[model samples]
Target: MDPWVSLDPPMPAGARARAGEPGGARELVTGALADGTKRGDVGGHLELAAALGAVVPRPASGSTATLWESLATLGAHDLQLARAVEPHLDALAILDEAGVAVAAGPGATWGVFAAEGPGVRLVARPDGERWLLEGTKPWCSLASHLSHALVTAWVDDRTRGLFALDLRDPAVRTGEHAERWVPRGLPDVVSTPIEVEGAAVTPVGAPGWYLERDGFAWGGIGVAAVWYGGAVGLARRLAQPVGRELDQVAHLHLGAVDQHLTASRAVLAEAAAVVDSGGVTGSAAAALATRVRSVVVASAEGVLAACEHALGPGPQVGDASYAAALADLRLYLRQHHAERDLAALGRQAEHEGPWWTTRSAT
Candidate 1:
């Protein structure tokens, strides 16, 4: 079987053309995988991200589909690589949305450390003309490897603001809680807490602007695209020939996988179109993102179950790539706050009322 052949859906015509170009995203990832690059190799993954950064378009560009396609292609190749690259792309997008010029030197990778935790709070205080972040920020993934990060810190008792920090700042320290990240999937992509004292930061957008912007919704959906791609990667493994006659049960499972992936692809494409058209804004963009993410989550979970039931323990135990892919996807899907997100979507729908009404023909 061809390495690229699988249950994966077709990319848009333009996306396919860009991906097929020599030294494009597809060629870069395929070459890296062929060279036996490990998923946990953060340095190698960061380098790949820097190279792809020059090629992949930012989200909501006229071709949002191409941006998502690039993300999906990365996820399908290696979830850990996707994990490393996603935030870098997201940081760039956030900066763009905030009207901040990305003036970093070449090969400068970034991460967005916005997740807040109890007992440790990062706060930004005015220091003359500059802002200084002082406190601990949890879930700073690849902080040590990255050159800069767009971090969220408390600006006051009731507000949080986005700030950009240079990780190389002498006041910044990482690996505070590294040992706590021992999960089997994407184990190498450690999200440890970081401590900062008097680390100078540049304010990105106004306080509360990060979460309020439409791009936040678009970024969430972009992540779901990556999840969808990881599922596609797993589904492709199910179609791999095992040098033996496949049974009916296996074929049935493959069909089910196709069903889920097809639905997921449709939703992602629709979401991309909605984003590009600017039809959804403010609360509506968040609602659309919630809906798209919920659907993709279900589809990815279904694909995982189907693959496990169909392939049995043989591949899980014998195939290293299959095992790693399954593990990485499992852990990555946890980012979707499952029931909490569904409940939020439910609230949004309830407030909107009758969201499924058909339009009248003129």
Candidate 2:
């Protein structure tokens, strides 16, 4: 059997180095990104964000969604920037803990640190005397930077294992992410596609060490919050113009839009509270994730509809800033969690026959 796994206590700690980070730096950087950065081309900057999140306080327990939220919000770009660094801590720390390699590159982007194929997933394999890695990855947030990748690939039969690869080595092909559907919101993100060519990697620990099992819940939080932030930004800009003269229909539509947005954000805050409370990986959590992703999508659409109704004329045509902001929000609205990730809860919850029957048999 292959020997690798997600961390029992997924994710790690000791990341809090960003406070000394440039004051308002996150705001400034995202502001610049609002208009200049093209959609799907900021791989370089996203790596920095992932690096920042990775360097700061990681979660004490892997299950806690707070850590993921913190990392995602370390800045608008953090999710993509400092994501890879999460896995390499042990890859390097184990060596340090064991008095071996003192230097290791941070695997800031976790997605890039993985490999997957057909039946098997994650890191684990027993190829004679060595394990072999093979698979393709998507949305490797820190693809552009970092020294190593923690990847998951097909192991034996249908099982998977998580493995770490030192990117500095010649066997591994580490580079940039490919063209993706989602863009604009995380322009600096360099999530790319990569291949491992008979790469030499070591098993850091055991099988299924966990790279955030409740990951959907965590992803939901960040995407929801970003929507809230974007709404706030859009509202702040619209407040003045909103007060201007408007048709009765437009006024009512605007008011309704505002109320919808406000309610959506309140729900988002509640979702955050749930994550903070450690309800991030259950039936309720999955349901909540679906709800939040849906709400954010609706909110973004409403905001645009309101804007178009109110300013779709000369003002909007002339104001490039307003148009650009709307475009950015639209990119994130395409937020998608594959059906496989969504169905995870049900798959695990199922009993061979029926739960009642199984219990009776027992």
Q: Tell me the TM-score of model 2.
A: 0.58
Query: Across residues 144-189, which tens digit of lDDT does each residue of candidate 2 receive?
Result: 5555655656566655555666656666555543555345544554
- How far out, in Å, is residue 96 in model 1? 0.8
**Window of ten residues with lowest summed lDDT in model 2:** 1-10
Q: Tens digits of per-residue lDDT for model 1 on 203-233?
A: 9999999999999999999899889889988
Q: Which number leads on TM-score?
A: 1
Whole-model Cα lDDT of every candidate shown, in order? 0.84, 0.49
Q: How well does model 1 score by local distance difference test?
A: 0.84
What candidate 2 gets wrong by more than 4 Å, as runs, is 1-51, 54-124, 127-132, 138-142, 145-150, 174-191, 202-212, 241-253, 279-281, 313-321, 337-362
Residue 220 of model 2, lDDT score: 51
**Candidate 1 error regions (>4 Å):** 1-36, 353-355, 358-362
